[model samples]
Target: MSDVLVAVETVSRAKQLKAATGALHEALDARMMGADLFSSRDRYALFLAMQRRLHAGIAPLYGEPALAALVPDLPGRAKLVEIDRDFADIGATPPADEPVFVDPKDVPAALGWLYVAEGSSLGAAFLLKAAEALGLSVEHGARHLAAHPEGRGLHWRRFTQALDAVELTEAEEARAEAAAVVAFRRVSRIAEETLAGA
Candidate 1:
């Protein structure tokens, strides 16, 4: 158990979740090579390829009963199609390599993965603007970074509400936190690979 997790034990599950995953998030961001991504079209395409890989890795979890029951919108949230649209708009094809698989063996772990995915939509507001600066838009490209149809804030609140509503043993909670860190690391690696390829 991490000291951060231990310290957040008394907080709401959502807060605990955020606190536990904070370090992993920061580390992943540091490795994402954001400045380089926005510097060129090829770099931006590589970033989208990385997004495709990460989203594909977790796409299977949306169908799990435990996850689907809580997040009904899960099925529609797969970003691969939107990513493909963005690729077409940019005159690029998706990379041929297989995605890094991120399998969560149980419900709690799936929740952890979903937390990262759903939370990403909240951050996409900034990314969307950055994409626009590259001449991409929700209608033409960057659909994956577009604001949710239901609105970002409402969508995230619903997700966190369902997340907190789930009951878990301490062990399960730890597993969830661990899974979140794993998700971050996997995406970070993909980002690094994308930048290298760019």
Candidate 2:
């Protein structure tokens, strides 16, 4: 709905989403960077806390009938269990919360939030490397950040192909963009609150 949204029909839905949320993503990334997320285990725990919340929040999206119809392999991508293992590996009690988008009435908007969740995987390669610096590994405290067995590039390609194939109305497109901004802002808020203590 804002000036950043372009002709949605002219570009892939994935790009439309990226363009719509570019500013928000930059801000979120900057905020996370300043949080010193991997300087030590204590700080990294904060990162995992937020990751736990996020993964739990979006885990159901992978199974939602409408979304699954769009992304067939969606159900296999959940990482909540991996996050829990990371907590156990470090002997930390994992935090708990309901899904961020609880049975969202707006499927289009739900897709936007789901986009943020799946899109995070695309950046996990870097995050996983940072975790390794903290003496974490895929089998240890960084399982959630590990690339998909199919690999991040191929996995993301399958996801985007599914997303870009959708035909949505102008209003639906706007809603999707707005929902993505909201999702990113939520992550920023969660990170800020959690890292404040770290």
Candidate 3:
């Protein structure tokens, strides 16, 4: 929590916009529901609430008199457009032809997968972009797998090894590269059946 404030600036409107945008992206990216875990109505209700607050906070900053004048217009708008597109992608209906439920026990896993696919694509993109804008070199990525909280965790050693391989080949250290790779992988895996058929 304390660390989150390090990048937050109260005075500068630009920083506030960036921070607000980042927070919104992070929330949208979180795994909130699965197929059988929650009703679509419940999930949509939560999403609408989140969308309202994000719009409320950023509206003044973007639409106000003084602050909007100060900040460069195009970049901020571009970022906003990016977020909007991501949200649309997330809200898009899943394929009607596919089975809605598989193993009951795997419902949580399926929901998590959807979140990672929908949320991670845009969340990772926004964070990586923000990190780049601030010139932060720290790389960040996430993986969702079948695991229990009290049971075994992901194989960190093996995961690190794969990341290391990527890092070694990359000429410049970039947080965005790692994030994009993770996002691409997630989306690709989810859409593989359709992709293969095509």
Judged by TM-score, which candidate is best? 2
Candidate 1: worst 10 consecutive residues by lDDT? 1-10
Q: Mind giving the per-residue lDDT tens digits that candidate 2 earns over 1-198?
A: 667856655678999899999999999888888888898888888889999888788777777888888888878888889899999998887877745664654678878987898888999998989999989999999998999888899999999999888778989989888999889988888887787666
Model 3, position 8, has a per-residue lDDT of 62
Q: Candidate 3, overall lDDT?
A: 0.30
lDDT tens readout by residue for model 3, 1-198: 455535663333212223334543344334332221123333432332333333322333344333223222312321233333433434533232222222212222221222223233233333344333433222211111112233222332222232233222222222323333333343334333332432
Candidate 3: the clashing residue pairs are 34-111
- Ranking by TM-score, best first? 2, 1, 3
Using lDDT as the yardstick, the better of models 2 and 3 is: 2
Task: Write down the TM-score for model 1.
Answer: 0.87
TM-score of every candidate relative to the true structure: 0.87, 0.90, 0.23
**What TM-score does model 2 achieve against the real structure?**
0.90
Q: What is the lDDT of candidate 2?
A: 0.85
Ranking by lDDT: 2, 1, 3
- lDDT of all the models against the reference? 0.79, 0.85, 0.30
> CA lDDT of 12 in candidate 1?
70
